[model samples]
Target: MDVIVNAAASADGKLSSRRREQLAISGADDFARVDRLRAASDAVVVGVGTVLADDPHLTVKDDDLRSQRREDDRPGNPARVVVDSSGRTPTDAAILDDEATTYVCLSEAAPVDRRMALADHAELITAGEGRVDLLRAFATLQEEGLEQLMVEGGGELIFSLFEAGLVDELRLFVGPKIIGGRDAPTLADGEGFVSEFPTLELAAVDRLDDGVVLTWRVDDR
Candidate 1:
C-alpha cells in the first residue's frame, strides 16, 4: 500500500501554537490541491486530535472535483480513517457524518461502550493494545482494498507513522506565517530520534500562490 503524509506548516516549522486553535496555514490553492489529492485517494486519514481540535469534514468538498471523480467511476469521496488509540473520537465528529465510509482505528483496550457508540457511525478496528498499531491498521486498510491512503495530521499521528516506517511520501506546504513557541506543535512530534536518524529525499518543489509545497520520499533503505 502507498502511504502519503500531507501537511502545511508555518515558516518556523510549526503546525500550530500551543493554544486552543485551528490553524489556517494553507491557502485556497493548497486546499484545491488537497481536494484533488483526496479525490485521488482511496482513503483519507487523520488523528482523533485533529477532529477534536479542527472538526474538519475530511471529505472531498469541491463540487466539480466530486463530480469529476464520480464521472471517472471513482467514489464521490474517499473513505475517512481516524486513528483514535483510546477511542477518544467523538460520536458527533464531522468525520462521522456519513459523508463517506469512516474507519475508527482504536486500541484493543478501548472501552466497549465507546466502541459501540462509534460503531453506529464507523467501522471499529482494533489495532493495538494501548495505542494504534499502524502496521495492523495498514493491513486492515489493504484488506478493505484501500491501498492508496493519505494521512493528514495533527503531529502525533505523523510522528507515529514516520517512526513505524509506514510513511512513503510527505507533502509539506510551507506558509509564510511563523508561529514560534517552544510549546507549539510541529510537523513530526513524538519521542524524536536520539541515535540513528531517518531521512527524506526531496522529490519535487512547487510554488503555490501563498506558499511553497515540497514533496519528499522517505528513504528508509
Candidate 2:
C-alpha cells in the first residue's frame, strides 16, 4: 500500500498547543488541498489520540470531490481507520458515523466487551499484544482493498509510522504562526529516535497562503 502522512504545523513546528486541543494552523488553500487528498485516498487513518482530541469526520468535504468519487463508482467518502489499541475510541466519535466504512485496529489486550461494542459501529482488526502493531494493521488494510492510505495524525502515530518505515511520502504545510511551548505536540512525538533517523528526499515545494507546502519522499535506508 502507498502510505502518505499529511499535516500542518506552526512555524515553530508545533501541531497544537500544550493543552492538546485542535487548532487551525493552515489556511483555506491548505484545507482544499487536504480535502483533495482525502478524495483520492482509499482510506483515511488516524490514531485514537487524534479522535479524542479533534473528533474529525475524516470524510471528503467538497461537493465536487464527492461527485467525482461517485462518478468513479466509489463511495462518496473513503474508508475511515482508527488505531485504538485498547479500544478507547468513543462509541459516538465522528469517525463512527455512517458517512463511510470505519475500521478500528485494536490490540489483543483490548477488552472483549469494548470490542463487541465497537463492532456494531465498525469493523475490528486485532493485532499485537499490548499495542496496535501498525505494520500488521496496515497489511490487513491492504488485504481489505485499501491500496492508497492517507494518514491524518496525532504526532505519536506519525512517529510510529516513520519508525516502522511504513510512510512513503510526507506532505507538510508550514503555516505562518509561532505556537511555542515545550509541552506542545510537534509533527512526530512518540519516543523520538536516538540514532539512524529516517531521511527524506525533497520532491517539491510550493507557496500557499502565508506559508509553504513541502513534499518529501521517504528515502529507504
TM-scores across all candidates? 0.97, 0.99
Q: lDDT per prediction?
A: 0.91, 0.96
lDDT of 2: 0.96
Query: C-alpha displacement of 147 in model 2, angstroms?
Result: 0.7
Q: Write the per-residue lDDT of candidate 1 for residues 93-135, one digit (tens) a residue.
A: 8899978899999999899999989989999889889898999
- Candidate 1 achieves a global lDDT of 0.91
